[model samples]
Target: MPESATYALDTRGERMDALEQYFREAARELREPGLALDADPDAVHRFLHLPAVRLQQHMLTPARYARHDDVLPSFVPAEASCAEWILAAEWLAYGDPGMTLASPGPALSTVVLRALADEAQQDWFFGRTSDWPTWAFFALTEPEKGSAATELTARLDADPSGEGWVLSGEKMYIGNGAHARVGVVFCRRATGPWGIEAVMVDTGDPGFHAETLPIIGLRGARISRLRFDGMRIPPERVLGRHRPRSRRGLQGALQAMLWFRPSVAAFALGVGRAACDYVLEQRPALAGAGRAEVDGMIDRLNRLRRLLRDVAAEIDAGSPNTFRVSGVKMRAARLAEDATLLAARLLGPASLVEHPWLDKAYRDVRAFEFMEGTGNIHRRGVFQGLLRDDYFTSRDRDVRPGRVAEGVV
Candidate 1:
């Protein structure tokens, strides 16, 4: 590596070290809610300005979001190595699952909107809004579907004018949907077949509307359902190229979204690690608890952390292993389940109690599996990848932590 590259790596190392310290301090802050003060809405909003537990959360949540964003640029940058970025994400999730869960909101999706938007629209968007506050409903999911981007079938027949198109369909299980400014709705063109092109619809359009969906878990995320009633959108909304019976528009957007699946997993690992940290400090308290169980749990968490780190390192090094990203995501999700279950056992009835960080971590981290293409889906992707001709020899496939499989949408 060049001296500049070496400097960048060192800088990232330092930044990650600092970020870890910040995460630890923030966790400490959450551990003491007497310090988390001003739960009052307006006061809480006001409190976010000052440097406190919540403020630390504010920074950390965005940091996790940025970690996902940072990976989108093909390689890790100087600020955060893939490893550090993943750790930061986990810490953020661990801090306040709600806040962390609410993250990926505007930051991750906006990167796609910015990349795919036409020049005029891009200029208009960036010129007016310095930072887009978007939590995408990712309109590909439907009430009864096989749950693939190709399964998304919102009609995308543009009006005769070509200036606008009408999108008519229902989108379910959108993240941060209750009150997000920007929305990316994927709809199939009216003139196409089953797996046709996707037009990225802007939610601000007249006929577009969004309603929240009540979900079993992740209450803090404000999951939503979207309905497009003759929603007229401009041509600039089409995000990717066209294909036979398929919309590649989602390809790019999905690139923007799915590329970070591993990062989401990394975020989960952080939560698991934090929960383990919290439990280990008080391991001797329980009646039947022994050092063996506690030590075993810690070892498991550490292993998960290392797993997350290895995938991140590979992606950063641009030599990601085959389906390694999926493996990491799957492992992280399982570890989260284990960590949360262990936390419940470690904390006893206190796991369900409020005013503490553990329960929120457990709740918030659960979104990891659901949001980033469920664990099983990615696993299947991994399985299919193992069978592909491109799987073994492609230079891109060599990326030990290459992006989640594409061309699915």
Candidate 2:
């Protein structure tokens, strides 16, 4: 049998074991604060001193770029693998998805910075973040276009004053936008795909405005709408300016999104696991239909967890399978919804009122569908991959060549 087929949820080695232990403890500590954050997103700032939040602040920084003063906890690796990071994200999210998103750190912006920013730009970003618990945003999804790069209406044009560039447009559903001191905004410099470019923006700049949106789920994320009205961006702030135009804008965004898709899937899995754990814990002695339903949910959750771990390992191995990632993300999102719904049903109609944490989990899971990409979006990608016969290729390191493993997806 392929290793992926027999893969278990436990860590593979001592290093990952330690990481899992650290994050599990961190998640436990975050539960109360997470509930607090869900009630009031601003409460996140009060918990920045926590070790988990501090570790997350620098989790993605390369060792060479990381400052000695900003060193993560001794238990954390100087350079953690993608699998480790994904594992940490899942565990932290299991504690409280809202607080996990709300915690101050680079968040999604790290991916874009790594993919597109110059050395100096990276240094500046890391330095600022190291100075304090900084929040950064990746502004790509627009109000109307909804992250469709070709249809992006945001424009970046050369300034008439000739000192820099001017950015103008609106971006909606931007995580941490309302609180981020620094971020990268995607905009078009001219017609066609190559014209698209990403520019660094400081929130303090004139004409840069952000407002937290009223959202029903993941309240701690503080998803916001931003408007850039002739926001001046220095010429040097353009990301990947030294690279080919084709690789600078949408390509960089795509690379970041591809890298992040697995993490997003992991978030959903964490929520599903939380729901399952909640059900099992509260009703320790489930009978007949109740026990069967909980068992079925657990089975599905374990399969998805294996698939996610496999995908994360592939990413760490420098082989990202887009089709598998999309499929896992699609299925994981559904699993989160189903698991939470099952918990509610099994616990009965008054469960939401009686169990606040589970209720919060139910709401937070809804946002995972829209984060990174929507279910509809991923379904289309999976469908396309199937048509191209791209879905069956073995990207798993342990899988034999030309042999598709069962239940790995």
Candidate 3:
């Protein structure tokens, strides 16, 4: 019998090949000398605007976002949502990791809005942006509170007239914040069952200030620090106050992370795959353990990809195993980091100085370590799941630690 694919895609091989070529072309365009680094931000925006928006529409259309609510339509197969995201991330990584803003920002916004917004709010925002590419950001990370953002310091004080509110606080490391058209800014309400509330803030608002913060990797992302200095927003601007089945505050963020972590790993795998391909293509003469390292990395990367697909399958089946997802997240992050390091060791100093793509890949891989959740955090989650006897409980097939089967999810 032929091998079973992890994703259960009807045409996995053909789809991947076609998708790879599509993104490879985009990556080639962006990787052109002086284009990615020196092009005007607006120019880069123009280049990516259409492709980005179309990609988002494809991912969210046909009732796919319902998967986030733990509901999958019968028309969509169990692995369909996961397949969409994995392919999306793979393509984004192929284009340039920085281009990730095209997806994650809009994706998080959609999740937040669906979870917290009323029908009118959704229609107003989603409808308006349906035509042109619009970016939305989830601003939860503050300067002081890195990953532990449960205790919000940002405050949302109600207007004395009982009509609107004033937001006063700062958020840091907001991906695509500087460039986002809309932002879901999370803050603590000053009154009435006070808790973290998400407020929609238009970037053009005078009090909504955003400045791009450059990073070593994913430079094109336009990550920013946002200062909401008494920004006034109408009452309806707030995401609805109704409590979701899941706890609010960190719970919302956690839920987003769970849904997104596997996809995040897919991007990391893309980075690693890019690096590995460079090594194979260059055929660079290597020193001790360099060739062996590259060989080992190939096998490891394949295993990680299969594992990620499996996690996605479980999630699609309406049994999101957080432990499995965390394991995949932790492993994929380490693999990306390790694969890049191995490639660097194989290629020597020349890879960093002479190969811009490889260098970018190296820098991009680092962000995966921190994106969605950190390695330590994911490891902790996996351990906690293990303690609760929930680890791998829903996996379609048994997978022992360090002994994953090929082509298995």
Q: Best lDDT goes to which candidate?
A: 2
Q: What is candidate 2's lDDT per residue for 124-227, written digit by digit as tens?
A: 77666655778888899998789887788999989999788999999999998999988889999999999999888889889999999999889999999999
Which candidate leads the pack in TM-score?
A: 2
lDDT of each: 0.54, 0.82, 0.67
Ranking by TM-score: 2, 3, 1
Model 2 residue pairs with clashes:
none
CA shift of 317, model 1, Å: 4.8
Q: After superposition, how far is residue 184 of candidate 2 from its true place, in Å?
A: 0.7
Better of 1 and 2 by lDDT: 2
True-vs-predicted CA distance for residue 2, candidate 2, Å: 38
Question: CA shift at 284, candidate 3, in angstroms?
Answer: 7.3
Give candidate 3's error at residue 401 in angstroms.
8.3
- Of candidate 1, the 10-residue stretch with the lowest lDDT total is 34-43
Candidate 2: stretches off by over 4 Å: 1-12, 65-72, 395-409
Error of 3 at 71 (Å): 30
Model 3, position 38: C-alpha lDDT score: 30
